[model samples]
Target: MTDGVTAAHGTGGHGEPADAPVSAWVLGADSGGSGLRITLAAVPEGGAPQTVGTVTSTEPVRTGAQGIDAEHMLAQLVPAARELLERAGERAQAAGLRSVCVGAAGMATLGGQLRAELPAALTREFSVRRIALAADAVTAYAGALGQLPGAVVAGGTGLIAMGTDLRNWRRADGWGHLLGDCGSGAWIGQAGLQAAMRAYDGREGGSAALRERAEAVFGAPLSGLPAQLYPRTDRPAVLASFAPEVAACADRDTAASEILRAAAQEIATAAAAVCPAEEGVSVAVTGGLFRIGEPLLAPLREQLHRRAPHAHLTEPAGDPLDGALLIAARLSSDALRLPQDPALLSLT
Candidate 1:
């Protein structure tokens, strides 16, 4: 345990002796799909988190492309992480840093690819001593609940729900756009597009009205979507932005509304599946789709109530950056004791 000061790797490379005494630090990175964001924070002796530096990176690679060459994406992240650390180190020279943690997407569940890559790359450049790599969802959990046994349902291009029993953890979904991601943006947009096509062909089940709207939105019929929507190859990232439109159309179009309602049920089911049916469970809803307000959350809450009647849903207290800082603080203490309220470090 660190009594007052400690030493760790710097932005240059890992495994190197720390140049200065240690204080406490946190670094959080959310990468994958469209862009990456790195946040560096410094926690003074007894003070709250203060921004040290930040960096942003983007990977145009698709999930399909990542499956073939994830290294390409890693290349984009490593440099940004290094940049943030460099700035953090300059600030840390005055305060000292204890630990660094990374909460990145497409890294945790897809094998240890990014896990090993991140450490190796950082070590080659910085002096990071204690480093933790976890799923962005896990980081979101820590940020939203701060070690509590709660779940977070993140709906963007992908939909996933993760929860912890404190000692152990369980995850419900997040199969990606191609496979599942029921209530995700990709799912909504894809469903909308498909309905439009069916309307054009007179083969659509019940999406006639929604189909017409989709055609109006996209100019030509749904068939033109493949090229118009995903012109850059980052199809999921491109398609994800339209999820809100689908939710908007739900009330106006029977087929669209049914699709949205079903999606809510599917997402809530995934969230509930991971949450034990016992009492005193906490749940939070986040992501762009939910930003549309009641059209999403109210339905999702109703669906979750069907199974876990006592589950409580709240807005996320903080974001991934807060989680990174909390994890770093815990590592510095070596007791994993995070702040009682992660929201205390909210970015905004």
Candidate 2:
């Protein structure tokens, strides 16, 4: 048995020798605004793969003129991969990496460089043959529903909804904070802040509760907020940090409650837009934005019922990292069923 590799069904048991050779290794990675996570798993001869090691980095990959900086991602990923391989012992490393699946937040629109370079780069680094570079939304769908006919709304600082019927992918409202992502945490926070500003100006449609919360969070004389907020590169995440304040004030503030309700409507509408019309298709809402809890979820449930009544609301089975691993496993076993796309789920 390898030092770090866990024995799977066909190795060291079930009539197989303890020294049974590993067939291959697969790598799964999820990269997003927050950071990057990589998982290494080993597949034994005629056995399912088991996770051997994992690594995470808090620094997100940088974006440059060409889009997501492939070099930057590789800089973080290669070392981590090497560390995992070394930990897995000689036998597991000898099998080598056979396939890789990387799910990145901007892979659909901002992954030109990744698509153009990642496959060849990975090939050089690990001799990888099969690779799936996917948009985070697609991975979120796979994570939530596992290739089943369903809709998945992933809402964090930004939001996107995706659905598939095993034929093609449908997407909605991932246009970032400036254009869409209507039901996202940033949206809610921006709305809450607007209400707070309105109250400061003695205007209509203002919430005193939100105003107090905002002032408490951002400091007094809220007019100074722009100076504090506008210069940062991570404006979306900063804005989203206020979403919980809105949720916290929902019980006692009419404006806050209304903001959440409207946000829910937008999210449900996005979900419905991508959801298969067939009855019983699963719908899942995933990500940190949903953690605002019943204040947001209760309204979201009601809105989903109204908008996607034929769809069954389901809890997410896993997250994007799990989805990437699932895709890698399927690719390794030659059982991948998700439809291929140029931008959303590119295969090589």
Top candidate when judged by lDDT against the true structure: 2
Residue 218 Cα positional deviation in candidate 2, in Å, after optimal superposition:
1.4
Q: Residue by residue across 1-348, what tens digits does model 2's lDDT show?
A: 112323222211134454556677888899987789888877656654467777888788898888999989988888888888888889768878889999998898899999999999999999888999999998888778876898999999999999888899999998989999898999999999999999999999999999999999999999999999999998988889999999999998999999999999999999999999899999999999999989989999999999989998999988887788778877887888889999999999
lDDT of 1 by residue, 69-158 (tens): 346555655565555566555665444345667666665445245444656655554556666666677777777776667677877778
The TM-scores of all predictions, comma-separated, are 0.76, 0.90
- Root-mean-square deviation of every model: 8.7, 4.4
List candidate 1 segments past 4 Å from native: 1-23, 45-48, 59-91, 109-113, 120-126, 221-232, 235-242, 337-348
